[model samples]
Target: MVIPILMEGKSKYLSSLLVIILLAASSLAVHAQEKPRIFVSTDIGGTDPDDFQSMIHLLMYADRFKIEGLVSTSFQTGRKQNILDMIDLYEKDLPKLKKHSKGFPDPASLRNICKQGAIAWAPYKGFRKSTEGSEWLISCAKKSVTQPLWVLVWGGIEDVAQALHDAPEIKKNIRVYWVGGPNKKWGVNAYDYIAENHPDLWMIECNASYRGWFMESESPKDITAEAYYPNYIKGRGEMGKDFIHYYKGHIKMGDTPSLAYLMHGDPEDPQGQSWGGSFTPITRSSKTIFNRNSTVADTVATYGVIEWRFNGPKINVPSDSTVFTLSIGGQHWPGYYISEGTYAVRYSPKQIEVGEYVTISSITELNGQKGTYVSKAPWPGKPEPNDFKLEQHWYGDKPDQELFLGQQQGAKTVSKHRKAFLMDWAKRWEWLE
Candidate 1:
């Protein structure tokens, strides 16, 4: 009788243990499913070396989200090999990372998803021939998942723009976070295409908000850009060693705010406070420069998209495929051949209160033709909708909003969360050690 009683007690204990184990496993599966799906389009090896720093930071935090793709955008200098090289370093450090976090993705999986994007910026219509990178982005967005794919564009938005051009339906399945300031200036044509065509798509055009990553006010000395590296990241691990190679090791991860947006807070609400800066819906406006030359009296709003149209000698080049060059403020900008002899180029002025002269020397009839225009403060009035006008989209804080540290337009929204995010990153850096 005593032996039977003991056996029954042991059976009950085993059943309770099994139920606890099963419950724990179920909890973990749910957590994994809740991770945001991410696709990154970066110009890692392009003119800016800061991309390398952002890539390293991304790899270290890979386990936090479902990393769907890594597409390199700059064909002139950046390549998929640049991303693969970082994966190699991650592979070397995988063992140590795995010791701390089981969710670290396999290096092989990451390499497989790394693809080369557009070899050049988009033509006049916003998309050229689709590349392997754009196709991969489409495939990821078309997946049957319930969550929207979060596209973090670290460099040119050409691929995302092209992917949308090819598969407009995918817009419903993806959300875009673009680090557009100088990047916007470079890829203005592609940016304009999406703004005009896909106004309803959910996107955060973070022009100056991303600047908050490195630029902060009243932050602790240890967490400042110069001090944080030596204090938390220097001599820590393989990632730490590789990080110093970019931007002289000072933290200029302008692209990192995209990741921070997903890391903490509700990504669904761009207006809500998060480690990434808050944003407001953008009011749309534009200016058109017609066939004639402009005098200094003609003015455009700073950051407002401007369309330059020139009626010149007709060439036999393919429609929407031909490229022309416009020299404005000593910078060469690409112009596209529209129907017939008309050529168009879209530009956004970055400087205010400065005179910009536009000249196109590529076309014979358009040669020696010069126009002068001055950029004033950004337009404050509500947009008057027109066929050529930009549609509504989300952007950094408005020009008139109160800011922290008197930072740039939307910078304070991001700078306000600096301490919380930096400290969180510090904890992750310790894992490398």
Candidate 2:
């Protein structure tokens, strides 16, 4: 009886030990399932207000995504000093609306908008950092181990291009989503640069000046290519209204006119009724430019022109063909708007967490629909359209939403930590779909 009793006690202890081990393992698995990490690289005030809008969106969605770092690049725009100061001020005071609004920025609520700028943007002056953009990107990529690193580029590819040229590891691991050219024919340097050095890296191109504006009409319902004016936008309430006010207030100078600013739909413009988001499907393809031999005589092996074809169709494209656009006022803007189009890739948060891998399924379709076929995968299932929420997301009730908007809009009546705390609170949404 004594021996039997001793055996039973020993068995119970072993079972408890097993339970502890299993629980520890389960905890580890859950911890490992955290969200995919993201990095944003932008040229603040570079092109249009689109990058500005993206910045706002990033601030909003800061919860669902882990923004390991933010690198604001400078190219084709202003030097780093002016750009940084402008961005610093902008971040300090992004105008927004109030009055019973949902997730929007309001001017009257949260007052000060000071946060640390990207490390490279320091010296608080307008000088460019000696550290190359690619080096920074490559360093960030190598440093991140907990999750995959995504590099979102909102300007010229010079920095990323430089980085890929310098670091092989960056070319292998980092995924790049850039908003720029392959305009119809000009500024093909990035494409040429990639072909020569970093061909393996994945890229998502958001074509430049892709969308335009629309004019106001009695029938606001007209089928239009431009941005839907005050009415449709107002539906988003104070936030949307404030945005339009800002756009109208600022866009009346330089190269164009009031009529050109007529609310036209442009992919690059942020003021359209049809707001652009991540899941809007895109197409990706190799960007290649073929030129004719410039020499008076074509040498047999040296200067002969090589004809190029896309798919199987014979394009009337010239080897020496050049693109030129003439404005209505007879202004000649010389160059081509060569675009390689944009590509869409889908990957799920869960799969990324479990497998530590994400895959690019395919480019978007020609009809502006998502692709029917995904080329490569260990995809958990088939590809489906993704409606992305703000990155680090915290879904709140109407009251919470109102509060959040109030904080964003600078109401002067709320907490200073509203934005920062809101960002912190967003981490709770990692498991949310």
Candidate 3:
């Protein structure tokens, strides 16, 4: 069977083409394994300091993150005048952002780049309703060529829930980065928001059953809700100084008769001492549908499966109601182990149902309290038992823009926490690396 085949110019060219095709396929494989695309959906004008700070960070990584679009949700609900006023304040103060932080973009410049001719800067076509917003987001996700979209929803996940229900096609295209819910203390509004409409879609409750909170205790002075501020903020420029002078009347801290929140770094939780990063994970299933419901009036989708009512370990809190610690789980041997389905969560002391999987949608914690975690738990959007109350609320001084701004200026103090937050931020920018 040894016949000498004569190789022509065409044969040589075909071999070269095959090599190029293989190289292209290998390059695509590498690209497919890259980081997720990030789209930030913030509840703009909600007066939440965390969302505002998060926005600054989002903008800082604008180039690295795909940032398909921005949507503003849950602004002050009643009164058109109040809404407009709040929007104006939000818009005006944007220019002042850079004055507070070197990492943040100049508000005016950011506006120019992102804002349309409207008071609000949502860029999706059509009326900027929540349903429409979610639809557009879904479209953005489906259309992304680089990676699966990670929706960094730093507000109510209602719109996204709606979008998922409306566009089943979008289910496979995105993963939600939810930042809401007070664990068991709060109902699954985000989950219910979609579940009612899309019965088949999975619900990754960020509340109940999910061991979604972590705790850390720092010095009394430094341990305020504004703990992460010092890691990111820098000096405000000229415009920021002007805004501070002019808009002094609008800033108010708590119910104080005259005083605003004191803007200073706490003496106890000094800039560089104890550093930590904390967040809770919600639960959803990979097998869930993409779109559950879509209409001219509303286009939403519900996608993903979440194991139901699965409970996990509970953290122990002190009678003082301030300090917290983890009920240490027996460390497992390196190799052999049974899964949760194969075993049960030892929740006998707390009366938590062992085998029930719970959904976690969001987590919140206060500044002063100590937080502890039962190290082994599924990440955001997985279910666990509703046993111990997650560490919630930051019991500290008045929350003010200035306090956050001050923290931003001194963000370097909590470098470890800052790095962790930035690592999540880095995930949004995986396409770059």
Candidate 4:
């Protein structure tokens, strides 16, 4: 009788333990489902090596977000293989990372989603043709998931622009965080295309806010960009060791702030406090229209959209498609055909205080037209708040504003939060051990 009584108690205790295990697993599954869906378009391994550093940091935090796609849009020389190589390094450190994080995705899965984007910059129309990277982005954005697809543009905006040109409906499902200062200069045409066409699309254009990631921080020396790598990152794991290879072991991950913005606080409110810094709404963009070719005496606002209209020989073709190439400042741009003999092209000036020569050439009558134009600073004045019924696009505050750190516009907003984010990142680095 005593043995039977003991057996009955043991059985009940085992049943309770099983129930606890099942409940714990269910909680983990729910947490995984709740993670935000993210897609990354980077120009890694192209002009600067800093992208490599950003990629490494992103892999370490893979467990925190649902990484949907990784695309390389290196207009200079970056390729998809660059991302693949970094993933191989992450695989080596996966065991340790998994021990600390619950949802570290399989390395194979990440490789499967890696894709090559545009190898060259977009033409005048802001997009040339779709590449594998753009196609993958479109597919990921089309997913029926409940969460909005977060597009983190770390490099050129060519792929993002192309995807939007192909499928404008996806605009409703994506949120963009673009590190767009120097990158904007490189992909001005693509930037202009999106800003003009998708004015209502949700975006956080971190022109200067991303500068805060590596700016002066009040954190301890051991965690600062200069000392943190040697103290907490170097020799910790394969990912840590690979990180030192770029920027001589110093952190200049200007692009990481996009990820940081999503890391803490409510991302829905751009003006609110977060690790990624805050931004104000961009109510308007400068646009100038001309019916004839421009001359050197004509000046346009820097980064402002420029549109030229021309009447050429009538031809039947797809409207809004690349029908002619506009050469300006020695670069070829795409021009589109409207109904009748009208041809149009849109361009954004990337340089200030310099005159750029322009020329138009095509097989049609719209050939051999020549002109020049000078790009000046942005038009002076405060832009009114966005009144668009759709989503608002955010940009850094003006330079004279108190939000700026140094000469870079809209930098201080990000620099102020440097310490908090660096400290949090330090804790994640410890997981590599």
Candidate 5:
């Protein structure tokens, strides 16, 4: 028989202390589970009108993530007016959205967080100057005591790069996700400068794969103005209408995936795959490292010449033994190599079609060692169906700030799981019910 332990003297106090400790631990665990802290810097009012659509999508779910800072950074549309205009509409819709969930922050609260970054286009060098946006980013990243801040660069990443440059300590507190592709053409110099300097910084470059938002039209009837806008989204809510209003009712929140990935929970994992897409690791010797590191870089367009340039101290490979090849979209094309300052290999496809899943790759064998690099492309990245454009804007003195106004092939990728993202967005709207 065991003697019953009675609560006497110190035993009673000891039990009480244990209970209090457990309760404190539970509270800390719940706090740890709270949503992530996020900082968003956008280039809205730029050449493409889609950033407005993305802003609307983000505002609707303002409560899902802790929005620390909202910065307006642009190469062309270098003003905060666009973000303000969207906030004005958001102010009106906040109440309606709040009814569904209590996570929505007050409109004034968000407005207070809004600030403008560098107004001048990015210079040839990295972090040429600082701005209110960059300083805010640095401050926000350092002030956070809970979790790492996810920095979504919906436009150029000059501000993020600047923040890291100014305060290297924040590297332990911030992560970056940049939407490249056409934007990369403009920020190539900055991108190169940052990559060379901060090679180990946590950054995700999402280029072509962002096209998954547009979706491939199954029939001529789908994705039309009347069907998608008026029939499906026109009456959902102020947010829905705003999306279709200027967007003509198309689902082109191409930048939405950056936040959507966070919305899916566990923003730290990029390999498991979620609404945002999956990614793989790459090395410096990787010819297609930029594309391969990105999830959607090759999913948008079925045909395009992907050029890979590798810069190193000295690649001791013999020219006669070096070979390059492009493998994607069920066809393979040989690539031509040219070495001036860096090693360059360009791939052009022979058989390719739009609205189909396509991946671009450049494989090389140097002196006897072999390496293969692969990635996806968006429709805009493709030149005219049969024509090619000069990639001068990528490295020249000026920032190439034009939309890749290439002619659409009237076909979309069949493989992108766009419907999942669409359905998730619909449930948030009251009218959709």
Candidate 6:
């Protein structure tokens, strides 16, 4: 009887222990599965061949992302078919890619996710009608998931604009990383609408360095036709050949940085160096409000505990009737109104939480003014500075005017991190290990 009692007690204890272990593992698995959920809208098989090149890099690392949608957006159209062609090649090489690492979604699964978007914009408009692309984006963005959907706009942002127009609420569910520059030129109207209306949406405008993926900047050796692609990517496999074939046996992977940015571990911190080159916040300009400019000067990188000081010409207004506060999405900084001309701003509630977006607003009934401001990450308590001094990031030896726009030179300036990635990527194609 004593032995039986002891055995029963031990069994119960082991069962509880097993349950705890399993639950712990289950939580880890959930966490491991939490790659950034991504939706890609590309204008491949269109005006530029770079989208196809970007698709190659994206498909090679498909296992790393929760790819929710492959959209064929505006340009010369036929984007969906191009995506299918790439997936078809991926199917042939699926086994090798899986052997390298697990979680390569079945080719058919990727195919199922591919959908058609608007073939043509509604003649000089941001978004006129919804297509399969817009609806699918809405579904993915609104999924009852904790993370926001990362929409990568490799070409025209028509689908995203259309989705926002159709379901304005989905903006809360999505973050955008657009290769703006030339793409912006194409979709200026849409870009303008999204910028003016969706002030709260987190965005990175890579017009500055996206060109660095293949052009100049941080690392150009990675994509040079003679030095890199021919030797590394050209003869590796069907996919390598496809990457080469996309642009006449060379490489044009300018769009890959957007996807690369997501793969660099911390998708939440855009300020960090990742697969995508680093970017900064868009300056307070009449044209750009929601976007982050890529140039060094126009960006807000990082800083410690400090107070922001703003000064403008004092205008005639009610003295006590005025309220000065930084407001955003219902959250406001408890402004300590200094005077009519100058306002000193600090993190609200004593500690400014990282990734918080707020708007600096001065309102006095008849007159009003506002601008967006994001708090820097937390810092150890340091002696407070007299006032907040805004600083611009310097991109290597780039010039002042060139630094802020980060256009051609700016993109190239930040290519170092990505060049290393391509070097490994080429080797991976050869080894598949």
TM-score of each: 0.87, 0.42, 0.41, 0.76, 0.66, 0.65
By TM-score, rank the candidates, best first.
1, 4, 5, 6, 2, 3
lDDT of 5 by residue, 1-433 (tens): 2334543656888999999999999999998778778898888888778889889888878877889888988878557788888999888777777777888888888888898997654433456677899999888987848688988888877887777778878877777777665566455445655655676667666554455456554323534334555545667766666776566766566677778768663556665455665443332311122222223324323223334444323444543123443344443323223333244333422122322222232333321222333322333242333232222111111112221212222112211445656656656665333
| TM-score of structure candidate 6 | 0.65
Each candidate: what lDDT?
0.80, 0.33, 0.32, 0.79, 0.59, 0.63
In angstroms, how far off is 348's CA in candidate 5?
16
The digit string of per-residue lDDT tens for model 6 on 1-433 reads 9999999999999999999999999998988678778999998888788788788878888888889999998567556999999998888778888777897888888999999997864322346689999999998998998788999988877888889989999977888888765565456546555654565566766654665666543446546655676667756767776666666766667788888877664666666666677655532212212222112122222222223445554656543222455453564443333456654443322222233344445445212334444432111112232222222321111223443223243453346665677776876777542
Across 1-433, the per-residue lDDT of candidate 2 in tens digits comes to 9999999999999999999999999989976555445655555554454444444434434334455545555434534443344344333334321122234333222122221223322110112223444555676789747554766655545556556656666655665555333221222334344533444565433331122111112212322213333323333422333344334522111111111111122322222211211112222122212232112221111000111111212224442222322121222222222234221111111101111111111221211221111111111122222211121111111112222222111111122222232233233112121
- The best candidate in terms of TM-score: 1
RMSD of each: 6.5, 18.1, 18.5, 7.9, 12.3, 13.3
Most accurate candidate by lDDT:
1
Model 3 C-alpha lDDT per residue in residues 1-433, reported as the tens digit of each score? 2333445666888999999999999999987444335555555454443333334334434333344556655434311232233334445444444344334333343332231111221111112244545666767767847465656554456566657656767766555434333311111323433434443432223221111111223322332324322322212322222222222312211111000001112212211132221122222222212111112232111112211112222334321121111122332101001233111111111111122212112212211112121211122212323211222211111112232222121112222243344334334323221
Rate residue 55 of model 5 by lDDT.
90
Higher-scoring candidate on lDDT, 3 or 6: 6
lDDT value for model 1: 0.80
Q: Which sections of candidate 1 miss by over 4 Å?
A: 1-33, 283-291, 321-323, 351-355, 377-396, 404-407
Weakest lDDT window of 10 consecutive positions for candidate 4: 380-389
Off by over 4 Å in 4: 1-33, 217-224, 289-303, 306-400
lDDT score, candidate 2, position 77: 54
Model 1 lDDT per residue over 120-195, tens place: 8787788888999999999999999888999999988899888999999998899899988778778888887887
